[model samples]
Target: MTKKRKSRGRSKGGKGRSDYVECSNCGSRVPRDKAKKVTQRVSLVEPTLARELSQKGAYIPVSYVTKYYCISCAVHYGVVKVRAREDRRTSYNS
Candidate 1:
């Protein structure tokens, strides 16, 4: 069979199996390695209030919200971009 991606679209190299995560947008079950994970820092205080608190030397707390998206949802949400045939084999971070 012909292959489209070297990793078969998953990052679980040499691992037998990976856990599944639900897509935040679609609620679909997808492999943890295959899903697109997005982490966002959320401020507990409003931006204006946070700024004011910061000026007063008050400590403002922030939380990290992690979201997972399936391939379809990721593409729909613009989390991942479709690449050309040649570009598909190249790593974006390289």
Candidate 2:
């Protein structure tokens, strides 16, 4: 597993994850319905960089990847939009 980074309570540094916190970017609170955990790894290929894959019928995965809040529980949580990097693959992640 990748080593955990420290949370500045905003930009960085939080172990594994905690109950909840406010989204620094949006100042929105989120619920941390915790106890269970999820993990994933993704590659970033920016719009211009992802174009090549689109030409080949391949697509990059899109996600929020930003520190955010639950907007419900007044806690901190990670938010992702889960989209396709390309138009053709918009229906799925490649």
Candidate 3:
């Protein structure tokens, strides 16, 4: 049985304001709490990521598709299977 990985919760670090909030992609400055209100928390999983749980199993979260915004997480309540390359190789061999 595989253990489920939990989301990384935000740190309400002491009152010192953030130095700057930058876009995860473009590095452009995002308004305060704007990044906080992102569209979705895109999947950070990859076969090579050491910490990633098995991508080939039935337990994978469906949000791996649409954005997984922290606050609006329920938007993608349905989960779809995205085949990982690791599992795809079996089809070719079969």
Per-residue accuracy of model 1 over 18-93 as CA lDDT, tens digit each: 9899999989999999999999999999999999999999999899999999999889888889999988876555
User: TM-score-based ranking, best first?
Assistant: 1, 2, 3
Task: Tell me how far the alpha carbon of residue 52 in candidate 1 is from the true structure, in angstroms, after superposition.
Answer: 2.0
lDDT of each: 0.90, 0.42, 0.37
| Cand. 2 Cα-lDDT | 0.42
The local lDDT score (0 to 100) that residue 69 gets in candidate 1 is 95
Regions more than 4 Å wrong, model 3: 1-19, 34-36, 39-57, 61-94
The predictions' CA RMSDs to the true structure, in order, are: 1.5, 15.2, 18.7
**Clashes per model (N, Cα, C within 3 A):** 0, 14, 3
Among the numbered candidates, top TM-score falls to 1
lDDT of 2 by residue, 1-94 (tens): 4323122123323445545645444655443432112333445887677888888989588654434344332223433333333442322122
